[model samples]
Target chain A: MITIFGKPLLLLYGQLTLGLINGAFYALLSLGLAVIFGLLNIINFAHGALFMLGGFVAWALLEYLDIGYWPALVLAPLIVGVFGVVMEKTLINRLYKLDHLYGLLLTFGCALIIEGLARNEFGSSGVPYPIPDELRGPLDLGFMMLPAYRAWVVVAAAGVCLATWLVIEKTRIGSTLRAATENAPLVQAFGVNVPRLITLTYGAGVALAAFAGVLAAPIYSVNPNMGANFIITVFAVVVIGGMGSILGSIVTGFGLGILEGLTKVYYPQASATVVFMVMVIVLLARPAGLFGKA
Target chain B: MPMSRRALLATAAATALPVRPARAEKPTLKIGVLTDLSGPYKDLAGPGAVDAARMAVEESGLAAKGINIEVLSANHQNKADVGASVAREWYDRDGVDIILEVANSGVALAVAGVTKEKNKVYINSGAATSDLTGAQCNANTIHWVYDTYMLAHSTGAAMVKTGGDSWFLIVADYAFGHALQRDSTDFVQKAGGTVLGAVRYPFPSTTDFSSFLVQGQASGAKVLGLASAGTDVINLIKQAHEFGIKMRIAGLLIFLTDVHSLGLEVSQGLTLTESFYWDLNADTRRFADKFARRQPGRRPTMVHAGVYSSGLHYLKTVGDMGLAQARADGAATVARMKATPTSDDCFGPGSIRADGRKLCPAYLFEVKKPSESKGPWDYYKLLATTPADEAFRPLSASACPLVKA
Candidate 1:
């Protein structure tokens, strides 16, 4: 059996671990996407650009100012969040009452403009962000050697994903936000300042993407086009997980990453297209996703 | 007698004064810098090539002459169709006399076809496929800079010679990756290495490589060659580290830009072959220093360096004569460049081969350990220098139609 399978157990475990790491990013990005989709009902094509901007912000902080990772972590999200707020107020809000497609289009245009400006300014080559001193080395875990930074990324992303889910699922503010999303007129009658809440919500969602970007900067090259590369995969992940459920998105994100990892081991050629292929299968078999509320 | 002498002088002046000055109209030489200005390949070509072109113009002092030179640029978006259309437009309408820096192989091939049709010149520095000079070779196109055959021969053959044979390839499932794998395999086998096994990863894949690494680890091959670049290279290295597949991993064609991006931790101890390094020699240092003054903190890539050399050669030819004369004098100009021991700010004293490949010494470099000290960008330790003759695929081995003919 072992001879026929060629170390199937080890391969599967390795693939799953890889999948979980990828899923962590997927979960974080999709969670943000879901939050925005739930309220704004816009695709937010610029989400990836914002994520890339977050990474660039972190890189700039380190490269130009000698600010460490801890500070950059806090500063990058805040800076990106502010940009998000400006983007929402100046551009996104204008398209709210119009066709939802306009919001998508506007965000898409904003994404192109942002990516173009960054590429023009920085060029397409990736800039390196040093791993923080605290998370520089590898930790031996019997079967595998895990880099402290990658492990941190997986954990930190999960923590953020869970905390966001908790906030949305529980708490009075969460209920009010949900109410606004379902029926903004009623929430406004309750004197909740629904418009302000919506604006903040969009900003918060963008902030999540930026946060992920900041985490990814040290691991991946801080390139202008970094977000564009992963955004399509995240969209496919969101589709597979079903955009309707937050938890589903999280599970699917991590789940697919592992599946992709396994594909790499067993059938390397199909590794790249496996996720999209899975998305197709899920859409055909269970349209609402595995953990979705259908 | 005085009146007669004055008449004679007036007659001499009248004969000396030229009648057809309009026939010697200053020729405007249009050179197209086809680069990815706003796409994934942009950093690899784009503005850097533009800057190189400007440097060439300045270095050649072409503007000082009566010749008028103009440079135009476009982004092909890594698509052959787009590149073809742009090349056609530039050739037919825009009067682009020469096209340089077609980055993507697909795009390069497309532009090569168009240049052939238009009877224009192409100096390809960006594309990696040897097929441009091989099966796809055209009289109008010159494959400058490095190609897959050079990379495969330099890295693969060198590794095999050093006894790091028995290969496992983690190839990107694309034309570029496939060709690289095929070419490298031939060199590996010829150098007395065995191909243990191989696998292909999808292009632009965003996932962990734990599985692929495990398969490679299980292959038991002394060398695991990564036939990929950019994000795939980054992810593979990182994931390979995680999976503990650190022994004898080889990057067939990794850019210094990629090494800079990956940093020391991910890139450390990995060996790769490169035609140009910023810190190669005194001339390179001078060129890189000047480049840094403009770019500020970023290093000049090989493609950028190639652009400067090719552009300068073009301008020099045009300056010596006119655009038509320069184009006609291609062989002579190329020979002159080869005859002169070429020294530049980027690569010092590299010779251009007859087959249009730049024959500079390649370096086998190992990524420096984090503790090796220094600071950021202090990444590589020169393991061995493969000389110009030894570094590239021999003329006899080249399938380039030009070489065969």
Candidate 2:
């Protein structure tokens, strides 16, 4: 019976719950971007395409290999991760010394090629991926019926995000990786295989993106262009969270998603622009982003 | 690849007669085909739309009349400014006699404005805004194929007739979505159905629609009317399936390509409307067979069929009027097009109204169950077919200035 700003209270609760579910994806995706940019200093523009590749790989695995969601969740990322490593070794490794724009351009070209190939293989109308049986139904969560898959998305994404943060911020290897980003030659002098670390870091970042893609495959219409839809928004999330800041991206991703959800409820017309609008304000207020170090 | 497809059309067309225009309109009749070549709509109205126009030119038999008919195509990329600039360039620089396809509603409307200013013919098959035939209607432009009014009246009335007494609309926030929702609301309300509420989501960006779906479920609306198109509709259906929300989901303006993407399982039992379907009848089948050969593994949607039919009618008018006059005066050419009844391999025989609106039969189809589909593109099972006279908006209701009270 209660109303908030002329809308029902139940509506706000329901939108907030749904917002958290969507925030899981933004958090998951931006975390990967944060890790890749934070450690490698390569603005991986192909991240979106790679994310799309992840969903396709899951679809392909299920379609061709009869690998269900459970295994493809593990296998798709592994396959896409290895491809990322190969890309790093062959092409991306060549651009470490160049300006950041070169890395961005190369990756952008990579995104186009990858998207084109996927489009050629699978037409843009998008193929459907079934929700896993375990998470198929909705939970009658009093105020609203929440899909179990959505609940799973939020939990799984949060777990992975926390694990990634712990590994990057708390562990010895993560500390060494961070050291390498600060001064690569100095980290190499300390005998900690810096090039291999960079390669692995890119692989891990790509793996995280693929993982999000796997989580998203069941939710979004599994298509080549699906990743392109979110990549720019995810990039906005990363910038708002403080680019290259792991905690910043993870926190800001969820915050912006909930903000976007509320925008959908209040001013649906401005829902699309709400995130970018926040980005402009945040950047003006704090150029380094919400959590980035100046 | 193209040779084989052309061979297929050539072999088939050898038996039929082209509506021979008595004389040449101009030495060269260059028809520009502008559409969304590389965006979300590319599958429905991109390259396929251009191919449809090409077929129309070829089938019009304008070539055999020693009239050099050239079809030039460009991708608007779903941008309004880009489409307007392209229209200006095509008319002013390339000497294009008329433009066809003009796919996205926003882009098509933008190009419509330019077409009026430049005094060039524009036949639209892609956009759904009835405003083209309503407020924005112009002598220089012909609103072809289907519009939001027909889609809403057909699908909305169908759903309401089937005991969907309460409705909730999940709309894409844009002019097209707004028009569809507005028109659909009219039909729903007129048919004694109450609209519970509606949600407008930012389009081409807010793909995850679970939030909106939850709101729809909580509202207790019997039917969830999706006043959005393309991937947005597909995403809503797919997610609604996952959530197992039992509200009847009705997609107002679903293309065959959209049904193809969603597959029979997720999209099954959804009643929708279309002006053209490749499997409608022998005429469409024969024409679609050649069109499928050109696109390869793809069936033509209504937009493509509209392009084919509209192109044929335009070229025929130009042929009748002569090149100099048709090219010099777009309004006269459009008047001539309206004066003649349209007969094509697609929509068969139809007539154009004074407001530059093309009238034809509209079909209501249910997406067949996976078990019912015989093969690929065997997606629709016809529920009903409205005759040409009743399929579109009546002339009395039109808001075009050309229409008298």
Candidate 3:
């Protein structure tokens, strides 16, 4: 019966919860983008397509190999990660010496080609991916009936983001990767295998995207345009969180998600554009982003 | 005969230069299919529409009747500006006499304006806005297949009668979605149902509908009216199933392709209405099979079927009143079409009203369950059929300028 700003508390709680669920995806996706941009200084526009590829891979695995969601959770990301590695060695590696614009252009082109191919192979309507049996039903959360799969997404994404944050900010491998990003030639001089580390970092970032894609498969239609739909928002998250600020992205992603969720409740039509609106405000005030070291 | 001499002269002209004939020896007409080839509604009516129009041209027997059909197509990309410019170019430079299947309602309206200004025929099959046959109806346009009015009446009234007496409308914020929502609301109210609430979400982008779905649940409405089409409706239903929301969903403008995208398990028990089903009859089955051969592993939606039906009817009109007459005067051609009762393999027998509204029976269908479905693409099972006259907005209530006040 409680009210906040004349809206029911129960309504606010429900929308906020749903917003956090969306925030989980934004956090996970932007976390990957942050890692790659931090280490490689490359804006990976192909991240969305890679995410779509992950969903498609999971779909193909189930369709062809009779594999299910649990196995696809691991296999899809691994498959997409390897694709990332191969792409780095053959195509993306060449772009490192050029301006960052080249890398962005290259990856954007890659995204278009990938999406076009998917449309041709599977048509525009896209095919279905079933919700895992364990996560099929809703769990009564008092305020609302939250789907168990959505709850799993929030939990899994937070866990993965925390783990990624730990590896980057706390571990020995993380320090080496950081050092290599700071001075790749010097790290190579010190015998750290910097080139290989950079390639692996890109692969890891892409793997995270694929993992999110796999997570999204059951909930959203596995359409080619799915990535196109989400990627622009993820890029905005990366920008607002500060291009390579890890914790910043994680926080901003969830925060903006809550904001968007509230928009859906209050003014449903602006819910989709609310994130970008916030991005413009943040960029105007803090040019280097909320957490960026200006 | 004059036809053979005209053919010889045309061939001679073809070898030398492109020729424009003044009168009939044989009538030649160019067709352009402007549709959403690669956007949100692409799956609903894209290249398949073009293909269906092509089929109609081939099957019209117009070639034997000494008519030349050249079909050209373009992706409108669901943009009104893009559609209008393409239509203008098709009419002016390419000599396209008729434009068919401008899919998006906004784009369809835009092309309708251009077709009128240019005095070219437009037989729209994809768009669902009833405004085409109502306040904004034009002499150049014949709204073929179905409209929001018919779909709304069939599904909305049917749902209310079946005890889904209260509604929450989840509308796509667009011309088509608005029209669907408005029409459905009227029918629901007339059927003694109450509207609990409504929400309009941004179209072509709002992929996540969990918040909207939860809001619908919060209203405690018995039925959630979906005033949207294509994957928007598909994703909403999928998310609704995921949330295990207790409210029944009434998808007002669902397409065959949208149901196919959702699969049987998720879309089962969802009821909708359409003018054409691939399995409606032997003739439809035959039409679907030929279409499938052209677009392998895929069957046509009602929009696609409508494209064929309208194209076939248009060709019949051209054949009936020689192609030259049909080509020169768009209004006169539309008048002739309205005067004659149309019969085709897809729509069976139908008629076009003076308001350019195509009259045909609308079938209420429930999506078959996983167990009930015999095979892939075996989606809908008919529940009821609304007779042609009662299916649409009656002439007495028409707001079209063509309909005498």
**lDDT values for all models:** 0.80, 0.89, 0.91
lDDT (10s digit) by residue, model 2, range B134-178? 888898889888999999988889888889989999998888889
Decreasing TM-score order of the candidates: 3, 2, 1
Clashing pairs in 1: A19-A257, A19-A258, A23-A253, A23-A254, A265-B211, B134-B400, B287-B345
TM-score per candidate, chains pooled: 0.88, 0.92, 0.95
What TM-score, to 2 decimals, does candidate 2 have? Answer: 0.92
Candidate 3: where are CA atoms >4 Å away? B1-27
TM-score of chain A of each: 0.95, 0.99, 0.98
Candidate 2 Cα deviation (angstroms), residue A251? 2.5
Best by lDDT: 3
Q: Would you list the clashing residue pairs of candidate 3?
A: none
Model 3 whole-model lDDT (C-alpha atoms): 0.91
Error of 1 at B16 (Å): 40
Instruction: List chain B TM-scores, each candidate.
Output: 0.87, 0.92, 0.92
- For each candidate in turn, the interface RMSD (Å) is 2.8, 1.5, 1.1
Per-residue accuracy of model 1 over B1-405 as CA lDDT, tens digit each: 357988999999999997875566676788889988887667667787888887787778766766677888888888899999999999888877888898888899998888877777788888999888677876667776688887888788778877898999988889999999998889899999988998887776454455667678767899999888766787677667654575688898787777776777767888888767777777877777777777778777789888887787667656655566656544454455444445566655666666666677777788889899388556778888777777766778777777687
Q: Which is the winner by lDDT between candidate 2 and candidate 3? A: 3
Error of 3 at A156 (Å): 0.8
For candidate 1 chain A, the 10 contiguous residues with the lowest summed lDDT are A1-10
Best prediction by TM-score: 3
